[model samples]
Structure formats: C-alpha cells, structure tokens
Target chain A: MSLNATLIAQLIVFLILVWFTMKFIWPPIMRAMDERAKRIADGLEAADRARKELADADTHAAEEIKKARAEAAVIIERANQQAGQIVDKARADAMLEAAKQKAQAQADIDNMAHRARAELRGQVATLAVQGAGKILGREVDAATHKALLDQLVEGI
Target chain B: MTTEAPSSSSYILHHLTYLQLDLRTWKIVENSQNFWVVNIDSIFFSVLLGLVFIGLFWPMARRATHGVPARWQNFVEVCTEFVDGQVKDAFHQKSKFVAPMALLVFFWVLFMNIMDLLPVDSLPTAAEAMGIGHLRVLPSSDPNITLSMSLTVFFLCFWYSFHCKGLKLVAREAFFHPFGKWLLPVNFVLKVVEELSKPLSLGLRLFGNMYAGEVIFILLAAMTLHYSAPAHLAPLTGTAFFIFSALALVTVGLVAYGKGPWMRAWLPLLILPAVIAAGSIFGFLPAIGGGAYFQILFATGWGIFHWLIIGLQAYIFMVLTVAYLSMAAEHH
Candidate 1:
C-alpha cells in the first residue's frame, strides 16, 4: 500500500517509544532485580555458614572439655596411688624400728637383773659370814654355807 | 399517518443519509451550503458495539490468570495469538513495541468490522429518542477515522525507518536506491510520494469498501414504502429476498478472497465481509424514510451489531501500524 504522512509519523513515534523503553528503562530494572537476587542469595549463604560454624565450635569446645576432664581424672588417680605407696612404706619401716627397740629393751633388763643377783648373793654371803663368826664357826662357813644352802635348795 | 407507506427506495435513502459536519476555513461551519455530507446508519451502532466489546474485554484486563483461562480470556488469547502470528510472519524484527501494537490494532479493527452484523434498528431507536441526528458507528466507514488510523500507522513506519536507518540512511535510500546517483532528485521525490501514499491508500481502501456496502444496503432498504404510506403497498417480500441474496453473496465473496491457511482464511475473507454487509443492510439500512418508531428500532439494532466492527477496525489499524513499524525498522 501507499505510504502517508500521518502513518509515517505514527510509526516514528511508536518506534522511538519502544527503543527508549528497551534501552533505558528495561535494562536498569532487570539489573536491579539481578543485583537484589544476588544479594539475597549471598545473605542466605552467609547465614547458613554462620550456623554451621557455631555448631562446629560448640562441638569442638565440648570435646576439648571432655579430654581435659579425663586427663585431670588420670592425674588425680596417679597422685592417690603415689601417696598410698609412700604411706605403706612408712608404716613398714616404723613397724621394723619398733620391733628392734622392744628387743634391745628386753636385753638390757635381763643384763641388769643378772648383775643385781650376783651383788645380792655376795652381800648375803658376807652378812652370813659375819653372823657365823659371831656365832663360833662362821669363818670357814662362807664356802660351807654356800655349799649347804645349795644342798638344802637341792633337797627341797 | 399510515394511509400510505413509504416506498422501499425512500426507506433506504433515509437510512443511508447523514447530518454531516462541513469545514470552512479550518473551522466547522454549521449549515454550510452545498457541502457534500452524509451519515452511514451502521456507524452509530458500530461505535456502541465497540463500547460493548470494550466492556466485555475490559474485565479480562483486570484479573488475568496464568492457569486455566476463562472463555473470555481464551477468546482474547486467541485474538492476541492470531495477531502476534501475523506480526511475526509479516514483519521480521525484534521490535520491542511493534508486536503488541499490532495485536491491539488487529483486535480493534476486527471488532469494528464485526459491528455491521447487528440488527439495523437497535441504536437508531435510542438515538432518535435523544434527538441525535445521523450517528454512524463504523469508524472504518468514516473517511476521517480510517484516514486518521492509517496515517498513524504510516507515521510509525517512517519513525522506525528514521530511528533505525537514521536520516542519512533514509535520505540515501530515497535518493540512491534502485537507481544511480544521477537520478537522485527524481528518485527522492518519487520515494516521498510513495511514502506519502501509504495511509491515503489504506484509509481509502477500507472506507470505500464499507461505504459502498452501506450504500447498497441503503438502496435495498429504500425500495420499501414510506412509513407515512399504507404498509400493505410496500414490497417487503421482494426487499427481504434481495437483502438475503445480497448478504449471501457478500459472505461467499469474502471467504473466497483471502490466501491463508484453510480454517482462518475463511474468517477474514468470509465472516468479516458478511458481518460488514449484514451490519450495513440490517442494522443501518432500514432507518431512512422511517417513522419515529421504525427509526428507533433501526438505530438500536445497528448499534448492537456495530460494536463488533468498531473493535475489529481499531485492532486492525493498530496491527497495521505495528507491522509497518516493524517492517520499516528492519528493511531500512
């Protein structure tokens, strides 16, 4: 068909509008949307990572605490065992020393008793000799008196 | 008043006549002497028909669904798809605006064209009561409306050319293409003339076809007796036969004319023309030489049918505009 001034004018205006809208308006709007989407995605990802990291940290801390408590228990047990060994050794040594002392005391008492008995015997004999001299025939009697005392004790 | 009826000739003549606006010195002069002006009866009803179409489809515009479509939605979808297909086939451009514009144009023009199918008396009856003189509903039949729409399409075509090819390229194409540089001035003037003729031809084509159809219907209606005359003498039987035959011919002729896929080709050719003819003959053709009552009926019927045509015409015009724009942008 033939072209006309009015038709041409209309076509021009329509084209201008379409081109302008596509070039200037649509791009910015689309870009803005893209940017907004990316930002949202990034935000979500960060939140997810943060949640995971917190969980991991909590688990790691708990594990470290468990290991520490176990080590502390082991150390306490070792210390208790060393203390018990030292106490047992000390008790054994004390028992041995006490026995030695008791034995020495017993020996000293026996030796003192033997010496006193000998001295008493000597005194008694001297006393008996003086009494015999006084009573006529006591001089030779020390040995004889000793012998008689022995013989009478034997007989009884 | 019924002593003698008007002849069929008079009836048709009255319905075909119009109260025209005459321009004098760039101003509209009321009651200018000898200004050739007349109204096509179909136009009044056609515009009302257009309004109705707008009403029906307007609701669809508001709550569009992505899922299952309503009947109206489906209709609209089919219309848009058809228009889109036409645009895609005719004009190869990633035209940001052209396709949608074409869709609108096709639907509007299609609706406008379809308005011719309503009964002739629907709008005229109401118009008569309101004392409105000579309202025609078909925008395509109005040279002014057709010319305006076509001219807008032409404008889009040129605008795309200038925008895409640039003034330099347009000037070059006009002056240098298809001939040597030696014939630049002649070529330029010829190209300009050719470009200038697009809207003129487009508008005139539609107007002439529609106007002729309207005139035939008027002639047929005029064969009836005048309303004031006795009704028995009027040749209603003969008129009805002639109208029916003429409508059938128009419908058949319309269908046979187009070259397209079998199913859809028949619509643009057959149905469209039939609607146009029917709208003119039954809707607008009966109002002339009619009594107040007859005129009212004729007007109302025409109003009812013309709504389709108004929308169809608008859609067609919009589509043509977009297609031309796309072509110009790409070809240039």
Candidate 2:
C-alpha cells in the first residue's frame, strides 16, 4: 500500500486511539495510584501520631502515679508530724498539770505541818503559863502578861 | 507467482502488492491508481487493530484498581507503566496527553508489527478461500502507515514547539541557531534539515525495517516454494540480503548524520547483517535438506528473532517519538 487515503484513515485511527486512551484510560488509573499513595502516607502519619500520643499518655500516666504517691507520702508525713506534735503537747500539758498538782500538794503539806507546829507551840506556851499559875496558885491571861510574870516566863 | 513455476521475484512481488481500491472507480484496483486510491488492507487492519486495542485496554482501565491486580489488569498495568515510563523518561513537560499517546503508539504499532511474524500464507490463503483477492496484514510494512503515524507525530511536534517556544522564539531558533544574526540563511537551512529529518527518519526507519523484513520473508518463502537447486538459491537469497543491507546502510547513514541519539542508528548495523546472513544460509540449507525441515528451522528461528524485532521497533518508535516531542516541547 502506498500513501493515499489510508494515511487519513490511519491518522483518524491514531487520533481516536490517543483520544480514547487519554480520556478513559490514563486518568483513573493514575488517580487511583495517587490516592493509594496518599492514603498510605496518611495512614502512616496517623500511626506515628498515635504512637507518639500513646507514649505521651504513658509517660503522663506514670508521672501522675508518681505525683500521687509523692503527695500521699507528703500527706502521711504531715499527718505523722501533726500526730507527734499533738502527742507532745498533750504530754507536756499533762506533765505541767502534774507538777502544779505536786507543788500545790507540797505547799498544802507545808502549811498543814507549820499550822500543827504553831498549834503545838501555842499549846506548850499555854500549858507553861497554866503550870506557872498553878504553881503560884493563879490563872494567867496570855493576852495581858505583866512585866515580872513575862520575865519569869522567859526564864522558865 | 506465475503460470507454471512460481518465479521467486514474482512471488515476492505478488506478496508485496497490497489490495487497493480506487474510490473514483469504486472498483478493486490492483495497481495504476491516478486518483483516490486506498490500501484497503492497511485501512482495515489499522482500524481493526485500533479496535482491538480499545477493546483490550478500555475495560482494564475502566476497572483498574490501586490494590492487587487481576491477570489481564496486570498486563494492562504493565503496558501502561511501560509507556508511561518511556514518556516520563523522555518528555518532561506536564502535558496530560503524552503518556497515553505514547501508550497508543506503542500498543498499536506493536500489534501491527506482530502480524508480520505470523505464517505469511495463513491469512492470505484464508482470505483467498473466502473469495478475497489479497490481504497484506502488516500495516507497519506499509510506508503509508508508518509515514502517516509519523505525520501525526510531526504535527504534534510542530504544535508543541510553538506551544513551548512561542512563535517568535521558534522563528528565532530556526534563524539564529549555532550562528548569530549574520548567518540566518545557513542556520535556517540547518534547522530545517534537522527538524525535517526527525519525522522522516522516524517514519522511514520503521517502514524500512518492516518492509525489508516482509520482503525477506517473501523471498525466503519463494526460495523454498520454487528453487530446488542449491545454485538457484544463493544469488536470489544474496540479492534479498543486499537489499536489506542497502536499506540498513541508508538508514544508518541518516541516523549517523542525524543529531539525536547517535547510538540508535548503529543498532541496525548489528541486527540486519546477522539476520540477512542467517536467512541466506538457511535458504541454502533447505536445498540440501529438502525444504520442510530447514524451512521449519528457518521460520521458527526468524520468527522468534522477528518477534524481538517487532517489540524493539515498537519500543524504539515510541521512545524516539517521545524524545522528539521532548525536544520540541523544551522551553526556548
């Protein structure tokens, strides 16, 4: 076959084929490939983000537990210190009350013993005056003693 | 071939002639068409092969998946990727059409070239049985087909050159290439020669190879069909060999002189001689071995080799077209 009408025919055929392929064939396949690539990229990014977030969450959880434990420890320590302070204050108050009570008792005992000695001294003085009055055959007043009687009582 | 004995030359001639129809006369004209004549075979086969391509690929493209592919889809995908790879390698501009157009040129030309490797007698004999006179199946063997396909590529180059360079730049490049403003005529001549040769070589290289290949097959077929004597085979086969050699040498000269990839021009220098020598030797062997055995060996060997040539020519045609388009589309 020489070049003639067949050139036109082949050209038309070639044009039609190229058109068909460009319109129908190339775009969808390429788009699918591109979409698949994008999806893969997106998935990988999401997975990476998830992994990072998971790590962050894990660290956060661990830190929170540690913080809670530290807070609990602090609370316990404060409670123990408060408890010790409360006990020490109660013991000191008790000791101070006990010492006050003991001092009061000693004071009371000293006052009672001094009163007894004074009562005894007063009784002996009265008795000595009465004995003197009896030996002189006379009752003497402790309130108004004469000078001579006072000197004789002093010598007795 | 002829009345009594199938003359080797007329056998080749008979096979070479295409079935043409004169539209003016509305009659099947074997030869001598001064007016609107069509190679009925070429048009029919080109259209048919085009339809075949559409039928085969359209569904695959329609149902194409991004995930794992089915068997036929894989084929389509591979073909698509191959053509796209060629375009991506050669053409850098972001034209939407080049990759698919490359795919078109590749598969269409590949299918047409494949028709040549079939048993030469099978289709013609079948057509004759169906009351058809002649059918030349290999459309790529027809210079009309190759030239017209290249004609489209030439137009694309023209369009893209203007598109990328603008008319002013294209004109400037044509007139002011290697030489400055003073030597416009020389530069113009050189630019015209260079640009014109792109499509000319593209068309003729494929046409020459396929045409020579057809002629060789016809020659070999004729040798075994007619010549029983060893002496009768050599000159006939040698004549065919030189014809192929001469065609290769002319194209080699063109590709050697042409400014594009110079290595491609030298490939024929390697392939053509080996094929011619083998064909001639095989043509000689048939006379001693009584035709069928040697014919089978020769046919099978050449057929396998030609299948490779078919694929290579189609690939080369696609890549060269893309390269030329790339050059044309590059910014001035």
Q: What's the count of clashing pairs in each model shown?
A: 114, 0
For residues B96-166, write the lDDT of model 1, one tens digit per residue: 66665554445445655654443333343335434554445445555655665677677778877998888
- Which segments of model 2 are wrong by more than 4 Å? A64-156, B1-5, B33-35, B66-68, B226-290
Distance from true location, Cα of B34 in model 2, Å? 3.4
In model 2, how large is the Cα lDDT of residue B293?
A: 54
Q: Highest lDDT among the candidates is held by which one?
A: 2
Ten-residue stretch with the least lDDT total in model 2 chain B: B280-289
| Model 2 interface DockQ | 0.41
List the TM values for chain B, per candidate. Answer: 0.64, 0.78
- For each prediction in turn, the share of the native Cα contacts (below 8 Å between chains A and B) that it retains comes to 0.03, 0.75
TM-score of model number 1, chain B = 0.64
The two-chain DockQ for each candidate, comma-separated, is 0.02, 0.41
TM-score quality measure for candidate 2 = 0.67
